[model samples]
Target: MTDLTPPAKRPANPRFSSGPCAKIPGFSLDHLADAPLGRSHRAAIGKAKLKEAIDLTREILGVPADYRIGIVPASDTGAVEMAMWSLLGARPVEMLAWESFGEGWVTDVVKQLKLDAKVQVAPYGQIVDFTTVDFDRDVVFTWNGTTSGCRLPTGDAIPASRAGLTICDATSAAFAMDLPWDKLDVTTFSWQKVLGGEGAHGMLILSPRAVERLETYTPAWPLPKIFRLTSKGKLIEGIFVGETINTPSMLAVEDYLVALKWAKSVGGLQGLVNRATANAKVVWEFCAANPWIANLAETADIASTTSVCLKFTDPRITDGETFAKAVAKRLEKAGVAFDVGAYRDAPPGLRIWCGSTVETSDVQALMPWIAHAFDAEIASLAAAA
Candidate 1:
């Protein structure tokens, strides 16, 4: 029997949006008081802040010493476009897409770049078989599909001795999952996803091979100043350090630094991963116990721990899209959740962010509200019938 009573308890923090996700627990605007407002990003203090962000990121993610990490303009999308424009024409390209973002990359490579790239895509809840992928060609893929709630379990499928570069979009996966730096020649992420920091800035990490590609090959098309990573066939060392191509939000940079500090206080990479894993487990367990709701991912191993997607599985759901939206709406109106709706391009469902910044207790509180919302929606459906 479905319980229509609203859950007595509600999540303390109702932010479950996948991007611009919830801030670190106990976050405060006052934390950004030290931000160098009205100062040039090229100023000494600003550069020091930027360098600290890079160093802390490397320390937390365990990126190799030889790999160059840069703070770039725009977010993860810009980082990806920069890499594609700067490095892809050097070799045969293979684009693997499982979700909307990945598909966007494929479109750019084929339609925009006019590259005769090999494209492989899987449905929303499933991932492409890595065994079928030819790593000999430069490979592009997202480590985790934020929209589809699917992720690559490990880098075991990629060969370490591959001739081509592996460019990975790890926006939602970085700081929350284990990334194999050796297998990835280029990796991109933004501070807004897992870290719950301000957006408009992207982090670009490059292996030695990626730098070599930048120095050795020039693309067929004209490179935008923002996208260019090399000058006179030499890699731009300044970008890899603290110098950015454009002015950045010093306030945003400070917020990221604070988030990074909080991350270290908890336990660094392992701690963040554990927090996200625990938060996702709450939802996974709820789905396991409820027949009406189920994880969108086809398999548990590939299921995302960050953007945990879910769908209604009840037989009574005639209009899946409408029903899902109604449920999400009820939860929002009840003040139990907000921005829990699925991505615009994804199938109708809820996308609850279970990133490191989210507390497990809040996720537990959310589960009962979800049940209440589902039951109320079902009752409304029956009444209409």
Candidate 2:
């Protein structure tokens, strides 16, 4: 092992948990004073702010004018549930998963809904074959596997003339990747991801075809009031504009507005993607030089730029879980990083957030700390042996 001493340069800010990520560069509660607190979300002022969040999301993300984007309850999960409950039974379903979040959706469809669905799965650090997927059937998949660090490159696998809808969980992908609007019938993401805003509210974007499905077909199962998207055989246009299905957190709404404004100030989506790309490159080069670590995703082309997961390659370590946890503990005790450990269901490894909210300089500063922690762990193991 190299020097076990800690690195002198620490990340200026070490808030790198995947979700509820770092806030915009200079985020402050001062920016949220005019949040219209203690006011009804249905009130004109509160509605205006909510509408502003949706509008800014459309402009910043370049969502098509015809697509309907709404702020819904329960973050990304709620949004996905709304889509699945409202739309799945109308057609034969095909669900694809490579990580925890994606698999969770598949469970909901097959187990809960009991729908006629075909489930395709890939282990952690890998992705299912999109080419083998039949676009003629409705498909649900995660655009970015946050826990696995694998992502769908483009919408090319989806045929343009397909008869089905593509529902994608893009929680970690939004604001950092280009989503093919034309290819997706429904897309869901939370503000707490790449944009680093508040949680419990999701931005659900629906294509024209998805709207038609909602208006034309109804599911055989019962849908709770929260999951209902259409009313009286028509899409609820008010929800698309500013009126939410239920009470919303105005404080969270205002914070998301600040994030969207920051995104615009930083040259919009492209700039966000570039910053994430640069951050991922740091880990890429670091892994190249360090033989002990390798990216969890084997396919370089499909590797994620947002949640960059890495696995230990050093053969000396017999207990992967214990070794990885020890290294993560060292980093946390040193206050150099926190919550960088792999997800509970994922393979034991490190999962780093490299979204736009994360700075390249901070990631750069974090590199040495990680190496130092690794060496210290290895040496401790050797001494114990």
Candidate 3:
């Protein structure tokens, strides 16, 4: 007896991809008109633009004055690889993973780097116990599991006084959550995440301790030019000061600048956090009101505000993967949502992005459509049977 009729209300913006998320509410190509086209990145104009991006990032993120922020190649993956190749292998390492991306890092460390790292992992909806971890060893973890829709509630478990560094992949969490900067020695993110900027650029923020590690420790293996952070046993200061190791996409840089400006106008980090929190609340409320669906995150505290994952729990459902895909397809076909399917490696469910660029009203509008799609899919399954 479920109402299968489509919802008249539809989200104006249907981009809900966790990465390369929805653009700012009023984003326009005109914002990038000032991008310096056809100019060398090393030129004065390019360097100035890049420096402004760095300065604004520090101001918005409230990064410490002694920390270093650099624009690196690739996206978040590149930034993470660069940090691992350059800074790890200096000490005993422990890798924590609860999602696909984190598992990839473990593979890189265990198989590629051959670091003999101790790896602790949990199921998709769960997180490893932070208290049981040894902070004395170099620790690498994701602040938010992009694929799992689970996140660390706080950085309190990390000790203030530890012998090792804490490297964090915070691509989806930055700008949308409270990041404990003091506890993180190396944090990496990409332009395409919360800000909805273009890709091919990564932000690498390093604490003083990370810099000391870079300057003193050298990996046993030779590093590629792009991964190298130190030269002649000294941290490459220019890399942190607008001098990139390789050429960059000025257009993408301009897009990031525009997004950063938008972030500031929305009250910077706290503002961005509020928007994401509110957006996710809409979906959380929807799940609470509906008995057939629920959050994929086992606990509310560990649930992600940016990539809010969901699972259908109807007893009538059969073949979870196909049912989830059918529901997502119905929503997509109805033009109410896009890219709402769960990650392939994750539990069968939906992953709706509720990042800062997404509006609360749009999320409110999309929830009804999800119910509509679910009802239609369920009826179709019954007919097929």
In the range 1-385, model 3's lDDT, one tens digit per residue, is 8777778888999989887788888988999999999999999999999999999999999999999999999999999999999989989999999999999999999999999999999998999999999999999999999999999999999998989999999999999999999999999999999999988899999999999999888889999999988889999899998999999999999999999999999999999999999999999999999999999999999999999999999999979999999999988888888999999999999999999999999999999999888888888888989
* Ten contiguous residues minimizing lDDT sum, candidate 3: 1-10
Whole-structure CA lDDT of model 2: 0.93
- In candidate 2, the residue pairs with backbone N, CA or C atoms under 3 Å apart (3 or more residues apart, or in different chains) clash, namely none
lDDT of 1 at 207: 98
lDDT of 1 by residue, 77-137 (tens): 9999999999998889999999999999999999999999999999999999999999999
lDDT of 2 by residue, 33-85 (tens): 88999999998999999899989999989999999999999999999999999
TM-score of 2: 0.99
Candidate 3: residue pairs that collide:
none
Model 2 misplaced regions, further than 4 Å: none
Best by lDDT: 1
Q: Give all TM-scores, in the order shown.
A: 0.99, 0.99, 0.99
Ranking of all predicted structures according to lDDT, beginning with the best and ending with the worst: 1, 3, 2
